[model samples]
Target: MDALDIVMNKDKAVPYYQPIISADKQEIEGYRVSGKVKGEGEKWIDLHPFFADNSIPDDYRQEIDDHIKQVAVSKYLHENRSELLFFSLNPNLVVPENIEQFIDRLSVFKSQGLPFEKMVIELKEHQFEGDVSNLKHFVQYIQSLQVKVALDDVGTSSTQLDEIALLQPDIIKVDLHAIGNSPFPSVLTEVLHSLSSLSRKIGASLLFQNIQEFTHLNYAWRHGARYYQGSYLSKESLTFLDKKSFTQALNKDFHRFLSFEKKKIKSQIALTDTLTKRLKNYLNNNKDFSDIDQVTKEIASVLSDYSFRVYICNEEGIQQSGNALKDEKGVWQYRVEERYRNWSWRPYFLENIVRLQYEQKGMLSDLYTDIHREERIRTYSYPLNDQLYVFADIPYSYLYEKDFLL
Candidate 1:
């Protein structure tokens, strides 16, 4: 079918269902409903716009005039939603001019009892190109309705992250493009797995799609995918019943995932405790210190990647020099503490550190901008046996160079 043929014909576009499974499988999580259209002698659905862009019919942009048809489509999905599972449809399929109309339709859905919550509207990664600010407002408005949003085809391009943060999607679907060759057997497992921790931090759920085999499903299950959709569950599958089956599978998968997650948290806590105690025992040896120098050496070595100079601010905001390194030997230069009121750091850490150091004696300090270095970094700090703060300068996420690069 030609591009013009699909738009003018309308009948050519059909809803193709893909199952969205929850690792917990209490019920069908949702249905990612994609539209199917025959490509020029190509059986594969033309999901993205770049395929033979030269051949696209000039008058029809995206083959779906969101400007007009969005209202009708919104009305259709809103009306037909099942309480058992969410019905996910595309938002960019709606024209920009018709966004208000779409909102109005959502209002009608709200009145009827469906609302956007049961109907997830996603935007195709390529379909969003205009003013993102306007798009954000539109998304925010939809969010106000309490309907969920998904950023379709994540990891397909660098822009996926931009849209993800801007749109604040509730779900980030892993793009099919990264799954091995568009033709070869899938082996891009490592790349797909990396996105899990990132997805978790943002409070977005990960879904692995375009998985054509059970092995791929296995990969997804092993790598933080809380949801899965593709042929292995059911080839060319499009039905509410498929949604139920997929959810059942996902529940079993997620049950195991929850167990694994708990175990990881436990292990991290145990190891952190062990490390803290060991550090304390080693530093407490009075023979090693005339002052804070011993603690400084260990901390500096642990955080050696960054060029560091430590400052201790006291109650008066004065840095006190303990003559810390006067006779202290090797590698202790990285940590030189002239005493400032050391308590300020702990109070600041207690008040500011997001994920680490909540009553834990030894943990990374909340990130603070290093006035000296003019960069953001966190100090891994623990109260030393001498009652002074022992801090190690470590770069964090904002300093991406420390992570993937170093």
Candidate 2:
């Protein structure tokens, strides 16, 4: 028998273990049983490529996902129902047709001695691309069984974001590859921010995986991620059957204390260096805010991630001139200085932006908005060092529909 036959025949191929630890408890809560493609470690990443080459039909998903429900969770629970557990299963979007089969089996396990509450069915990230309707029904049905669901590999793809919102999972497991390396990429940071917001909206927990060292754990901790599993953490088999090791792992590993201040100092200086380099490049080209209108127009495009608007302000909260946004219309008009020149638009000046730019010079103003734009738009302002350069982008609203400050 080749790989396919071996995969079907081998009990180990259908079930794998992931360690689950609590942020507050700081101990092994339980292990979730997940399905794995049979291969070397790196082969895990390229399993889909293998499937394609082997001419393995889409129908393989039914057998694979079914093997998960039958052999993985059922067998584990049969032997060790006394201990808590968490099982991460391949989502197998291809076999959504067998969703009812999956759910019924889980419900059967729930009815039996297995602790359904501890079973966490992880929908593997982006592997299966079958009917989403089957996937949705599967998730809802599992939740109905009191078996919690976790979106595994959350940082892997934004494609799952909407499904995450719609499904409202009990946990979101972050990928190991994302936060493991040095100089955590800005892209990952932005993605995590979006993931955190979505998690909050759904009242789901965040689980970060693959923390190679203390720094990775600290980063996740600061972001309010409560559940964790990683190497920096002491490893334990999260299995219920392995009573001796599991018992030992269940106890807290006291050494991992987080010093937020230290992390802050290190990260802040690094971030400052990054920002300074970026701002210096901006300063390098413009020399001064002479082309202030060009600067404001560019601000919207440059900081498209953050809604931007240009504002002019005097020492007090008095508004000198204000342009709150670069409209979608992209109209070319007066100076960033001109927005506030008409004192009647004085209402544009708000209490927030004043504190941000005041006393401190050449720093990013905290995000805010001009009250005059009916507070529909969010804004930020940077100080033009020269008083004559009275113009600067006030703030730009990111989404056109959400904020009218545009």
Candidate 3:
């Protein structure tokens, strides 16, 4: 027999609640409904794996989805009606005819003082198949009932911005699993920033899901995640925690995170100030730094302890000097390359150059991945003269120690 048949025969489907906490408010704002089924030896089977198996029929999958939603909402209406209830449904399982059935079940709760606005129906971004415009219609129809729509598992390689724009969900829940394992942190940060900006434009709030560590929380906060959830903060349970206890531990952790970030910012400011002054003095001492070899030697001596690389470009972005890469042994090596290759096309390259033209001081760039090195780095550009500019690349490690360097 199929798993769904077994589930229905045994009446084993049940809902588990995972709390979603507000990072800014430090309170439990809502709970995501997950599913479990009774198994041998008192073990519970997670419904995710079962739902993922393609061998299951569409009707059977919908049954399981409906069961979980019904149980979650019923329990919420009877026991707790204060916080929001997030219910996820697979797009493939969503039938146009079933909308009324789902609404009828939820209307029962509405009659019992459970507000329809508190019900957030999450649609997985990665699971949606076929025409997106159809999904948009479905989402709009659902929203017409005064229920909010949430886009789930966002901020992945498969995230479709055009579809998201068209759907314009009320909330975007970014999955943090891939972000923690991602090798390209700078690119990830940029992607998150883009998602955050789009959320604001579309009037959608950003929620970071699967946040399992302090580092994940740090990234979410920096990238504009207002709501957060994961095993790190709290695990899924059959019963909900009281609002008082939920906020107490969460508030303590939030304060600690803020304190740590404040100290890190102070240290970064001090370090950058010292390095900028030393660079200014070095450049002033050797006003006629025409020779690339001598200029690199002088700068390398000052920045050797900290990780650094240096290169020079003309006003038009043609490489005028070779690369000065700092080795692990604190030794500097200059590599020759062809001139006239332009860096003007790079992001923020021209912006920093324009700033240097006006300020005439060293300009620091926002954190980014170096195309050549494939490492997180920040470039500091200084105008050596009206026609020449020196670019110093600082590895992310020595810059902020992974403390949200924007």
Candidate 4:
């Protein structure tokens, strides 16, 4: 017998539930439905690998998918009518040719008083093949039934982004690979920021998956994630938890995170204030300075431990001096030929310059990746005079040391 036939004949597929929580960690927003097949000696096989295996016929795969959904709806969802149901499907099995029949089945659930609005159909990201326009039409038709759509296990690929735009899913599930454990986590932070911006533009929410630690949860909360799921919250099981106890535990964790964050924000403000005061003093003392080298030397001496590079720019955003960089040997080096680059196109360069020119006050930018060094850094810009602005770039390590980037 075929693998699909064996599994079907044995009736081994069983549904498991994993809770997805709200951003405030106050309530259970939904439950993701997964499946597992029991083995001879109590070993369980995940249904993802079974559906992923190419040897399984499309018909059999569709049947299994439909069966899981039908069972979950008929049993668990029917009982708990308040919370949402996140039902996923392999895109390969739900092609344009068979999508109409799938829609008919979903409509049947709607007729039973469980509307499609409460059901989020998650589409496995990589299985998005076949006709693109036809898939777009299928998404539109299902949405017309008031069913919300989601892109599951989304990665940071351009193709995946294009698919997201075309499908216009209501939620984007960030894969665990994109948010893995790392001491620095700068790239993961950047990817999350990019995804957050995209979701905001498309009017969709973000759901971070595989959040197995407090570090991951901290990152997600800071980046505006509204929905979350993983072993950190709860393991998949046949039974659900009492809503009151589930929310109470979640609230305790949430409050703990908030308490730490409040303390960190105060430290961030104090650090920024100290640097600003020192910068103002140095600029004031060097009012008559003409040589760029002497100015860089003085600035480096004052903020040596906090900054790595320093330069001067004019109101027109034209670089007036070469870059003074702190080298690996712990000494400062000047790059004389690195001048004349334009900064007018940067996000806050012109705005900050204008503010400094008018207010004669210094400004510090939010944490951002420096294109030249490809590292996270914050730039401090102070008005040296009406025409010149001194710019210093501080590496992210300093802020991280103060627990500001958590």
Candidate 5:
């Protein structure tokens, strides 16, 4: 359907609601409203293309948006719905002049029993063409009305952390569709995990959308998503769904996810225990710490099955021993230049060192991409002594062989 056709036939435009389910309650928390136009026969054409088309006049798009909002809000109020209502706002259209008008429209809905607190405005920050400070002010003004603001399309498109921080939205929306079927899923997983951490620090809830499969749902759940939205749970519809429609199904899926995560954790713990035992045995046999290079080579040989590289670091994260790395022929070679390198600048280097010292146990680091190899790997850090720690770099090949490790 043409944008002009939808704009001209304003009455044909309607609202479609996609349910957003909560992780904690495993129930429908709200519905994200999208515009659809009644097409030929019984089909409804999505106006997403029309809205996304920058060529379309702002007023033409806004008219259809208004129609959908009015119809959706009316239907919601008539049904006496208690769940939240999420409405997408174009940051480009959110100007100083029309902001008050926008708030007034929401105020009208509030007066009609739909509280401001129940309304969530999702803004695509990356698409915003206006000044960031102006957008920030607009978000602040609406938020002042007890209305929640969500920064949409985070970790997708061209969104940045600075924009998110500046907006300080009540929720951060991450679309799983962007990471679909990527060969380097580990890289994307790390990015999502970083976003999750940022969300926690900023006190914003993570809402994962476009979850079209069990893996996507599991990804969302594992990444600390407070809410989920996608075809996997419920697709967009003309009418509202039961609040607890997905509760039972979600509970079952959550159980499976939990069990799988537990298995992964157990595998990690088992590996850690195995490494600790091996290290203890090696230390018992080699009492002389004078030959650091020889000690590293010996330990690397002992852990040849699990690690491709092994080295020793001091309490301050300075390399005490040269890196004993495995070659293509499975021969261990010492890289002397790797010694005396300061690893304190790396993330969690100091933190993990502290944990190793306090726990006096081997710690398995989270899977991350190695800068040198450009492949996902984990580091096993063991406290060799009060002033020394042994680090082992487990290769991706080793991790790939273990089902739970990856």
Candidate 6:
């Protein structure tokens, strides 16, 4: 139905609950309340489009939104539910003028036996049109009432990390649908990792939505997601479901994910061991570290099957030897221009150097995109001495060939 139809029949607007499953408990932690209107043949038509449309009058949309919340809240209280009730609020509508009115409405619910602590208000910060400081104040006020705030559609378009850090919402909702549709999915891994790190630092829980398959669920689990939602686990319903509905299934899936991750870690450790053994054998046979260029080329040749490029650097991250690069035709070539380049600005450069020094062993890095190759790859770094370190770039093609390496 069109906006006019939905608006004209606003009384038909009803709340549907989508179950949110917790990663730790492997059970339904809460339900995200969404609007659905009774349409032709008494079928439930989603009101997301109507609410998302900016051209519609704010008052008209607000009326329907408020109605849905009232109905949902009454139903929740009647059922005596203890789980969290997530209500999505339009950030544009939450201005300073109407802020108190909104709080008063929540207070009315609190008077009706609904606990403020169980209420979660989800806001899409990217859609906020007014001054962010105002929105921040509104969130702070609601949180003061013991109501939790959740930033919705994070890690998507126009969601800035600075704003997230500033607002410091209690939960950050990431849309897995966006990641599945991204052209460069690998880039999103970095984005999710950053989001994950930010959430941990800020003490916010992560809720991943639109999870439609096992891969999406696994992605959410691996990226530190605390809560999960979407059709993969359960569909939105007119009534609340049993809290333990998906416990058995989630446990089975978690087992599979854990097994796969363990295999990947074992693969990385085995590769590190193999590289250390070969490097130790080569170092025992040849001791002339002064010929840096020749030494790098020899090492690259010895590990050519695993690495596409090899280089030596000092503890200060200054390249001491030229890059030994493998050509498309499998010929090894030395690029002396790369020598003397300072890599101290790179992430984990110094930390890995220190780790290598203290551990006195080889280290395998997490998967990342290589700027030069424009491909997903891993770097294996080994300490040659206190002052020098050798790094080998493992190509994406090789990792893809190995089980659980990619």
Per-residue alpha-carbon lDDT of candidate 3 for residues 1-406, written as tens digits (9 for 90 to 100): 3575656654777899999988666778899998888777878878887777778886677678777877787788778558889987777666454667767767876886778899898888667766777788888987988899999989874877877899999999998887665333666677888899899999999999998877787777877888989987888999887655457776777788789778867755665676678888887778886786567656766767664787778888888877778777767887766345688987667877888889887666666777877876777677878988877788866765545453
User: 1-406, model 1: which lDDT tens digit per residue?
Assistant: 5565667755445555555656655455766655555555655464435222546653464445332234334544555645423333344444467677667755665665554577677666556656777778877777787877777667655555555666677777776645653322322433454467667777888887777765566667767777777776765443445335555655565576667657755644553465466666665653343444444555455444442544332233244433222122333353233544444454444352332334546664433555555556655545443324444454444345532221
Candidate 6 structure lDDT: 0.91
TM-score of each: 0.55, 0.58, 0.80, 0.89, 0.96, 0.96
Q: Please report how far candidate 4 places residue 128 from its true position, in Å.
A: 1.6
lDDT of 4 by residue, 1-406 (tens): 3465545554677778898888764577888988877776877767877677778877777677677777778776557656788988766667777787888888877776677888998886566678777778877888887888888877544445667777888899886645567553676666667788899999999998888887777767777888888888788988766554467766777788789888867766677678779987776666775897678778877889888999888899988888889998768998878789888888767778889988776667777778877877877777888888888888877767866543
For candidate 6, write residues 212-296 as lDDT tens digits. 8888888899999999999999989999988999999999999999999999999999999999999999999988798989999
State the lDDT of candidate 2 residue by residue for 151-235, as single tens digits. 8777875556887787678888887564546546555665787788888988999998876676677667766786776666644
RMSD of 1: 8.8
Instruction: Return the candidate ranking by lDDT, descending.
Output: 6, 5, 3, 4, 2, 1
Candidate 5, residues 339-364, lDDT tens digits: the string is 99999999999899888889898899
Off by over 4 Å in 6: 1-11, 181-184
**Model 6 residue 384 lDDT?**
90
Ranking by TM-score: 5, 6, 4, 3, 2, 1
Candidate 3 clashes between residue pairs 3 or more apart in a chain or in different chains = none
Cα lDDT for residue 79, candidate 5 = 95
Residues forming the 10-long window of minimal summed lDDT in candidate 3: 179-188
lDDT of each: 0.54, 0.56, 0.78, 0.77, 0.89, 0.91
Q: Which stretches of candidate 2 lie over 4 Å from their true place?
A: 11-14, 35-54, 57-84, 88-96, 125-134, 178-180, 234-258, 262-406
- As a whole number from 0 to 100, the lDDT of residue 149 in candidate 4 is 87
The local distance difference test score of model 1 is: 0.54
Which structure among the candidates has the greatest lDDT?
A: 6
